[model samples]
Each structure stands twice: as C-alpha cells, then as structure tokens.
Target chain A: MGIEFQNVNKTYPDGTVAVDQFSLHVPSHTSTVLLGSSGCGKTTLLRMVNRMVDPSSGAVLIDDEDVAGVEPVALRRRIGYVMQNSGLLPHRRVIDNIATVSRLNGVAKAAAHRRAHELMETVGLDSALAQRYPGQLSGGQQQRVGVARGLAADPNILLMDEPFGAVDPLVRLELQRELTRIQSELHKTIIFVTHDIDEALTLGDQIVVLKKGGEVAQIGTPQQIVESPADDFVAQFLGLDSARRTLSAAPRDDGGWFVSDAQGRPLGVVDSLPQHPGQNA
Target chain B: MAWILDHLPRILELSLAHLLLAAPAIAAAFLVAVPIAWAANRVRPLREIVVSGTGLLYAVPSLPLFIVLPIILGTGVRDTLNVIVALTIFGLALMVRSAADALDSVDGGVRLASTAVGYSAALRFFTVELPLAGPALLAGLRVVSVSTISLVSVSAVLGVQSLGSLFTDGFERGIVPSIVAGIAFTAVLALLLDLLLVAAGRLTMPWVKGGRR
Candidate 1:
C-alpha cells in the first residue's frame, strides 16, 4: 500500500531530464500531493509508481517489491490512474466506462456491471445516466465517471494527475470536496499531482512542493509550509510576499474588524479577535 | 428507350455480374488496407513510404493495370479474376491513405486513457482506437466504394465481362440507349452502396447520434 521511490531518475530520449534523483515514501492510506508548476516533473514522479514511465536510474517499490520486476501491464492493472480532462472513453457508456478495469481483470460482465452501478452511486452519479455515453455528460459528470473507473478495480494506490483541472471553478471545488469525502471513507493511498497551491493545501495530508527537475523544495503539512517556508523560493511560490498573504485588520464603524490584504481588498469582517492573540499556549 | 426495354434481361445480367465483381473487391480492399494503414500510422518511415507508394499506384492507368496484373498474378487476361484484382488494387490505393487519416483522427487523450485503464496495445486498437475512428473510416469507405464501383467500368477496355461490357457493346453497335443505360445503372449502384455504408455506420456508432456534448 505504501510506495517508495528510491532516488528515481527519468531522462527523456530527447535529453530532457524530467525527474532527477527523486525519492519519497508515500505513506499508506494518506493523500500525498506533488505540487509544482509546469516543467517541474511532478507528473513524472507520480507515474513511476505504476511504471507508466520507468525510472532510468533507480527503483520504485510498492509495498517493498520493486516494480521493475513486474510486467508493466500487470502492474498497471492493480494501480488506479486518473488524468486531467476526465479521459473517459467516448465510445463507451458511463456504466461500461466504469466497468472497464473490472472487465479487464476478468470479472464477469454481470458482476462488473453490478459493481459499476454501485460505483456510480458512490461517485454521486445518477443511475439514469449510466446508459449514456461520456460525450453526452457534462464535464463534471465525466470526471465523476473517471473517478468511478479509477476505483472500479478497488486499487489501494490511486494516482490522480490534475484530475479536476479541466472543470469550472465551482465544479472543481465541488469535486475536490467529493474526493475528500471519498478518501475519508476509502482511505486509499493517493498520490495526487497539481500546480494549484490552494488545491494542494486543501487536499494534501503531506505536500511535497517540487522545484524544477523534481527537487524537493519543501515537504511538510500545509501549515508548516505556510508558516515557515524552507527558503525564498518556497516563500515566493506560496505567495507569502504577495498582498494576499500580507493581511491587515482595520476597526469598522460597526465594531467588527475588517480584514484586508496589503492592496486594501477586503477579505472578510471578523466579529472579534482571538482571546489569546499571538499566544503559543 | 425501346432498345433498353428490348435488352432488359441482358442489362439485368450485366448488373448482377457488376455486383459480383465490385462487392468482393470492395470487401477485400478494406480487409487488406486496414492493417497496412495501421502499420503506416504507427511508424514514421512506413507512413511516408506508404503514402508515396500508394500515390504512385493510384497514378497507374487502370487499363494497363488490368492488362499487366495477369502476368503478375498468372491469370488469363480475360478472366474475371483479373478485373477483380485490379479493382482491389485501385481501392487499396485510396483506402490506405483514408484509413491512416481515420486512425489519426482519434483523440490522443482517449488513447492514453485506454492504456492507463490496463488495455493492451492490440486490445486498445480494436476496442478504443478503431471504434472512435469509425465515423471517419466510414467516410473513407464511402469514397472508396463509389470510386471502385465507377472504376469497374474501366475493365471493359480489357475485354473483361461486367457492367462495362454494356458500354463496349453499345458503342461498337452504335446503340445510344445501351450506353445511357450503363451510365444510369453504374450511378445507381454507387449511390446504393454509399447509402449502405452510411446505414452501417449509423447502426454501429450510436454514440454519435443525438449526443448532447
């Protein structure tokens, strides 16, 4: 259930070093997020767990077994992968799309469909939509189907690559909340890759902030990174120096305190200050 | 008009002969071209070679191909097999390019998703790639079907029996009605086959019809 990347390195055929000496142990039943901007190799590190991209120089072990010894297809079957754009099969109906992995693993058609129906309910999709094609569904609904498909085989390790990146902001927030709800119930080992800082803070129990070439810029809980960035790069990446992070409180005529950013944009109005402000105990 | 009525039975016979030749050639061309197209689509070097090579094949005059195939296939010049083989070659020339384009039209995201979900390369091609490419492939097959039906008439120049024979015989005896009948029948046959391909596409690809997204 736990995944360990032992100094893994990936250099593309075109001489681009996407990942370099990346090592991390993703604890079982926890959500570990790899957070970085584009070209930071966050996705490459996530892919090594399932052998989608084999590491050029080091080993990736799942539950203490090196993945290199396992056949790529067999290894992939046991690992659930969800990608951006809700990569559902356009030709298949929602039920069949969710049932894809179960069928591939040789489950009976009747049982797979039965499980797919259950997963549809689990993902908050209506059973009435099960017979419709993916193209006929909204983007948010399609992503729900993608999540259902990823969980179809009941995989312990789920890799999600910007899984909610393609939807609208409102839908994305809803989906993020749904994932939180699902994870609480399932407790799967999830390795999620994303560039959005807020999303990383919201979902990650352990956040790995990656720099270029898969360098670990910082690795900690959201509070740890926000409170004490390891360096200036981490501080800047998290917008600690920006107006949004430099908030000030002003007395309002209504006796409430107005909290605003350095740019004077009102964030909110607080009824009262904390009783023990700035006190550690 | 009287001449067509007088030779109604003969016209019917020639039409049957025409279907026999064109139908098999169309089916054979599709079966052969898909694998070749898949290979071309997968490899860069093979794609260039196949595109240019098939272009040259298409450029070869059909009369000469009808005559020359007997020497290569070791069949008699007048045999129906020669015409069928010639039509199949012509169909392949067009079909290989179309099939390659059709396969290319499939979405890259969908293809990657299939692999991520544990489909093997071969299984993905038949299940994901091929079905997603269905509408485009059906369009290509329509072009091939119409052209193959029309080109079967060219074999009349090589003395092979088909609907084309009506054209030759009518011209030789100065019968205008026979030539007119031949053109009409060939047009009608092409239209019928094109409609069949469209219907088959609609039946198999239900996802495309009335899809909201």
Candidate 2:
C-alpha cells in the first residue's frame, strides 16, 4: 500500500468529528479518489497523510511507516499537495514558487530554477512567464503553476484537494485531461479528493465514497460503483436507480459501448472499458 | 530665490543635518515597528494594544515630546538625540499599525498554500508573507518619512539645530528673506524625499504595474 489508514479518527478542539474511524489502503502508482459531498471529511482525511491534520485515534502510514513519527516539514517536502484555488504565494514569481520544494530539498539555487523551468514545461506552462509573479497569471495558468510546484521535487505521492473545482468548465476539462496525460508518464501514487462523482469516475483507479459521518459508504472501482452500489445511498448518490441499473451495454460498430436507460434514452457511452471485466473483458 | 544662492552654504549644512537626523531615526523605527506589527498581526490582543498604543504616540504633541526626551533618556537637553528620539517615536507609532495591516491584507489562501507546500514557519514568514506585504508597508513608510521631515523642524524650538534653525536665525535678525528660504528649502526637501520613496517602491515591486493580469 502506498498509504494506509488504520481506523483513523479526528475531532476538532470544539468537538466536531471531521473524520471518524476512517480506514483504507490506497495502492501505489495509481490515482485513488476519496469522493464525498461537502463536510464528508474528504479533506480532513487527505491532510492526515501529510500530517497537516493529525488523526485523533489510530495512525496513518506511508509505505508502512507511521506518518506521526516523521517531522512535519520534512514529511511535507516529500509529498506534493495541490488545492482548489491554486494556493500560490502571491509574492513569489512563478519560477520561484515552482522551485520551492526543490529548494527545501537542498537543491542549489541555479539547479532548482533550472528544474522549475523544466517543470513549467512539464505542466504545459510557457517558460516565458517564468519571471512573472502569481498575480500576473490567469486562473488556469496559476493552477498549472500550482501543479508544477507540486511536482517540482518529484515526490512519490501527490495529493490534490478539489484541484479543478474552482475553474471554468472549459478550463477544468483541459486541466483534467492534462492531469491524465501527466499521470500516464509519471505513474505517481496520487490521492485525489473531489465531491464530483463524474470527476472521480473519470480519474480514479479505486474510489472511496464517504458518508456524512466520515464513514466509508463504499469502496470499489468506478464500474463496481455504477453497476452494483452497496445500498440505496450509493445508488442514489451515483444516480443509478433500479431502472437505470437494468439497462444494458452492447458493442457499437464504431468501437464504443452503446449504453441506454430503461426508456432507451442514451444515458452515456462507454468510449473504452479498461474498466470492468464483466462489461467487455 | 536670490537668498537661496546667498545662503546656499548654510542651506546645504542644515539640509545635511536634517537628513542625517531623520534617516537613522526612521531606520530605527522601521526595524522596531516591523516585528511589533508582525506580532500584532498574529496575536489578537497584541493587535489591539499595539495599534492603540501607536495611535496615542501619534497624538503626542511634538514639542513636549522633544522637551521630555532628554529627561527620559538622560541625554543633553538640546542634543540632536532629542529630535531623533521624538521622530523615531512618531515613526514607530505610524508604521507598526501600517505594517500589521499590510500583513493582514495578504491573501489567506496564499498563506495556507505556502504551508501546504512545505514552507517552514520562518521561510513562509520571510519569503511569502513579508514580500507580499511590501506595497502597504512602503505606503506606510512614505507617510512616516514625509511627516518625519516636517516634524524634524518642530524640534528646532528646543534649540537642537536642524533645517528649522533657519527659522530661528531668520526670526532673530528679522530677515524675512531667510525665513522664506527656510520654508522653500523644507518644501523642496520633503517633496524630493517623497519622490525617492515612490521610486524605490516602483523599483522593488515590478508586479504592481507591468503585468497584464
């Protein structure tokens, strides 16, 4: 397991249990999404891995080593984190922000800057904007800078907390695709947190659906989630009612699945199913 | 204007003294106030105490403060230390509040991002927080500088010679020409200092104007 939670719990000082008895094994080298609605403790769970929010009970282990034993600053330098608003430092130039983790890792200034330039290119940012401060960049560009900064030191794991939730629909799609492309090359163990089920379906290798009380409602593949929901809550959450679940998928001449609802309305197409074995494999 | 040329040597001397006295006082104030302001920004009660305390310092009448400085500091009554001490007090009063406000104005999201990205407390304070607070702090510095320049003249009443000495010497001899020269010189000096500060701010903060955002 890349990261494992052994019955972890978190309660705020004011007595709010942000996360309660959460346990999961996130496999290495794949994107595992902790999907939930607001206040479902998805963020709290994600922060625990980096020790930003220490669990109140039990432990969070990375590569079987409990995170609590590590110095927070050192531990954080080894884990890349991105947030919804592209939480970039306003004072630093794009290059400096990207070089941040590398500098913290004891990389020399010139080498860190060189690596930052390369990372900017890796995240699809134009190196021409390297000298400009964060305020000078557009929302999309800033988010790209955030991604570039996250990947600078090249840590084994990356955490994304609502990374694309704030952007426009068009930009969001572009970033999602860009992340997919990056993941194909990097193969880094990524723990992505999102409320959007569609996003989790598109990106996750394994999906953990969280309930309001911070309990795991279901943990399965996207196909498992859509096809056989654990209960009414999971079925309703994915919009997979009894009627829709009855609908079947068949091969299309053009090389995708023709999926329809009970009323034969085209629900969604399965362009490819490197997904469920029962569906096509 | 003719008096300006005739008294150019004296004008230069007083101007140098004026600058010499104000520079150290202003620098001292900046060094002291920044930490106080930063502390105020972080601690809620400190914010109230520091800001209110500084506000009261600004309300202090300059002449009395100058007269009281030697007694408080155990220095010569007419020593230049009196003027320097008084200006330093006024500078700290104005700047501490401004610096605190500057730090507060930095984006919360940005700060959290800094922490998330593995910035140590000290690194984040110096790199992310302080630089972002620059524009507001610079504005505060500009105000402190111009006000300090004008207030330095008020200390001349205590017989600590400065550019304001021109006023005393002119008044004693009934030389209206010398008095006009002093006023003119003071205005020119304040204007020049203000412009220098503005230029420094522009030079330091390139993101304020050049970017297309």
Question: Which runs of model 1 end up more than 4 angstroms from their true locations?
Answer: A250-257, A269-272, A277-281
DockQ of each: 0.75, 0.60
Highest TM-score among the candidates is held by which one?
Answer: 1
How does model 2 score by TM-score? 0.91
> Which residue pairs clash within candidate 2?
none
The Cα error of candidate 1 at residue A78, in Å, is 1.3
How good is the docking of model 2, by CAPRI class? medium
Model 2, A68-161: lDDT tens digits are 9999989999999999889987756899889989998899999999999999998999999999988888889999999999999898999999
Error of 2 at B78 (Å): 2.1
Residue A18 displacement in candidate 1 (angstroms): 0.7
Q: Between which residue pairs do clashes occur in model 1? A: none
Could you tell me how far off, in angstroms, the CA of residue A264 lies in candidate 2 after the best superposition?
Answer: 8.6
| Tens digits of lDDT, candidate 1, A129-198 | 9999998999999999999999999999999999999999999999999999999999999999999998
